[model samples]
Target: MLSVRDLWRRHRRKVFISVGVLGSGYLLYKLYGAHRRRLDALERELAIQRESEELMKVQLSQIMQAHFENIQTISDVMTLPHAMHNLSCRVAEELDLSQLLERLLQGKGQPSTLTQSEKLNLWERLKILSFTRMALSVWATTMLSLYTKVQVNILGRHLYIDTARRFESSSTTESGDLVDKEDQQKFLGTVDFLCQHGMPPLISDMEAATQEALKGKQLSHFFNSTALHETIMQILIIFMSQGSPHSWIKYVMPEDSATSRIDDPAPSDVTEFEQLMTEARAVLLSAEFGSILEICMKVVVNAVVEQMGAKFRGGSIAMGLPLARVLPQVAQMCPLLLEEPSKNQFIRIIKCIPEVEPFFTRLYANMPSAY
Candidate 1:
């Protein structure tokens, strides 16, 4: 019904509308792509920020750890003087020199066999040492009286060594004849009491006894008797028992490696000392005192080698404080204690595995044969 020119115009109008719509659509698509790119950039920036935050957290943690270590170091240094002074006073007060000296000088040649003059000199020396020890005991007791209470009641407390012996015996019995669970519990309770209560006071007394011993004139002579020397060693071990297996290791013998002279004449004395040291270590292991055992063992090894003139292998004390071999098991039992020195020692001990491996391997290999 329309003319040709009208038709052409309408057609042209439709074409133009279509072209404009297409152009708008393409522009919108481009804008969407740009928006997507911007979003991705923002996400990347966020990710980077998160990564930076994590790095900062890690750095902060390291800073805190270092700060804590610094604090602990400062605290330890500040406390050192107090610890030293207390040790000196206690050492001076507790050792009795005269009685120890007399015991040292006793059990000699018969009066008839000895010249009268030599006998008199011996008697005089013994008397002088005795007098000196007594004087020191009196002085120390007086000086420390205000601070330390002499609990005679504690002295009356005795260990049921029989119970300990019985428990040991029971462990050896045939499986069928083994002690009942109830009996085992009772024995354990007794041991706990002795360890927790009995031993502490006993240790205190032992310290006091040693102070009495060291108070005598001619302190060197007091160390001469094997019996007296043994008693002193035993007392020292007991004093060390306070911190438990850990304390045993912590003790730094007044003697250091630079000065390894036993003025005491009995060369055999070292054997006895080593035996006691080994026994203390064995007890610690059997008790399963955790990482404290390892730390204590290291302390003991250091003291014996450096202070007590024991021996050494590698740079470490030769006495068996085998950290590498013992630490993994200890860490398993007490992971909480594994950090810093313990961790470092654990690593060192691991490195020493090649050196100590033969000893352990041989031990394990021999076990079946022993059975």
Candidate 2:
């Protein structure tokens, strides 16, 4: 139907179109194959690298732990200057203590020679940790000093009072309810970490530091400084957060039932009361209290009130004029703090104590001016 030239032109066009389709198909196939090959190679390389990294981590952990033990052995009885110098050398040479501590806590650092069962002896476990912390303290001081200083000046100063307000505001919410979910989780996570991995190490560190300070005649000096009070209050706040709903103080200071509940011999003097109030006030001003308020208000404040009331009822306070005066002040600040029947209970319990009745009567009479 077509002329020779036209037919030939049409045939060339078809041939060219076929060639282009084939070329495109071939190119696509090659690209797909290359992509698959790259994926396979990448996966294999990643597997190998991960295995190598894991092995290295294990080896490094073991080596570092060995170094720790060796250093501990050498420095345990060494003079303070010598010990501190040795620790500094280790920090400079081995690894930053912060990194080391992070790895150690994650269980990715050195493998312990002791089995899980073998490491349960509280005292022995503490000794080992104390040795490590003593070395790490210097590093901690260097690393955290700047950060804590800023926090103390800026955030820390307002933390306790702010926390109390926050806790009061948050009482209506559910356990995990927060506008910022991530923050809530982070706080809960920190509580868990302290409960599981932190407390023993902390107690160990404190005990060790106390012993060392005593040896150096630094206890009075340390006590006089706000630093020690802040630290203790923080620990106590952590404990309060993790404590049971019922009796946090009871758990901490178990009742000695042998003593009479009625009279209890009127606590001789007020030294114990003074000591306790000092501790409580210090705790009330720490970051821990702020954190507690941030997490939950009704729960913590109620707990604090209950515990404080228990101290009054459970013979923790005695006949000291200073204590009587201070007790009224604390009551004024916290102000029958717990909600509902619990708050009534706090007031009622104290009222029932014959020895404390006169103080409360005066406290109640003078309440208007006190605040």
Candidate 3:
């Protein structure tokens, strides 16, 4: 039989092999724990990055939305010729200076009619009209400038977000990319057309790549849409009008004085925002497309001259060079003017005018379609 020492020596390799196996298992377990911790940390970091990215997207969306609102406002401003035209007639009916002057000069059989209050009221109206005229003069010129800039950058081209931002910044700050000459005539020429016939409100607020989108909309369709004006107000909300956080609470919960409303600054006046916007639009439109005073004066002059059988300022043109484009627009608005008997009488009156007779004859004489 083998002795104890001899058995120990022979089994030594087996003992060592078992110890090696245990050591390797412990090392693997530690490595696995470290790897799991690293994986968790990486996942957390990725989640944080995703949240930041989403926040950035939201901010970007708000900026883009504000930008588009401004563009629509500008476009709407350009298209207000028709609306302003109607507004002009209303103004004339309300404020007839001739009658007022007549009353003032002759005293209407007594000076009592033109009291201090009446004088103050007349002065206020005059001041308002004068201010409107001045504001429109400046604003309309700026709009023309902006239109030239937009067309040069993206009239026949696309409007990228960066380019649009440039436009917005340029409008506010008057510093950005330069506009090309190609845009100059394209935009300015349209101003004449707008003054003559007035534009229809745009169909969609989205910018179209081509001018075809703007060419042929019906004015009768968009006679009273308020979307354009409201869009301008939205722009005001984004840039100029600051909404008070607790102002609504005051309106809703008037008695609450937990901390006292006096602790906060007085609520900002939001109602004036609409007033400011409408006035701005009106002023710009009036300046750009001949003021109410001017249009009314033209009508009065046209009537007096037509009664004397004279041509109106040598046959003014628009829409394929029609003589006196304003008359057609005036006719469209007046049902009495559109009747066949009235139309024939008006034609005869025009035929008798010296400057108009030759132009009308030339217009119809060569064309097979003419009467």
Best by lDDT: 2
- How far is each candidate from the true structure, as Cα RMSD in Å? 23.0, 29.3, 23.7
Q: Encode model 3's per-residue lDDT on 54-102: one tens digit a residue.
A: 8756755565555444544544444233323432343244323445445
Please estimate how well model 1 matches the true structure, expressed as its whole-model Cα lDDT. 0.34
- Per-residue lDDT tens digits for candidate 2, residues 283-336, read 323444334323332233333444544455533322222222222323332322
Which sequence of candidate numbers ranks them by lDDT, best first? Answer: 2, 1, 3
* Clash totals in order: 18, 2, 1
**Global fold similarity of model 1 (TM-score):** 0.33
Error of 1 at 89 (Å): 3.1
Model 3 ranges with Cα > 4 A deviation = 1-8, 78-160, 163-330, 334-371
Each prediction's TM-score versus the true structure: 0.33, 0.23, 0.29
Q: Write the per-residue lDDT of candidate 1 for residues 1-371, one digit (tens) a residue.
A: 47877887879888888999999999999999999999999999999989976875565456444543443343234322233234334433433334433433453534454566665555444443332332222222222211111111111110122223434454424343122334322322221222233333433554454554444423234221232324334444444454544333222211121121223312553443332223223322333323332333333223222322122223222233332222122112211112222233332343253433343233223311121
> Where is model 2 more than 4 Å wrong at Cα?
1-8, 77-371
Residue pairs with backbone overlap in model 2 = 61-110, 167-297
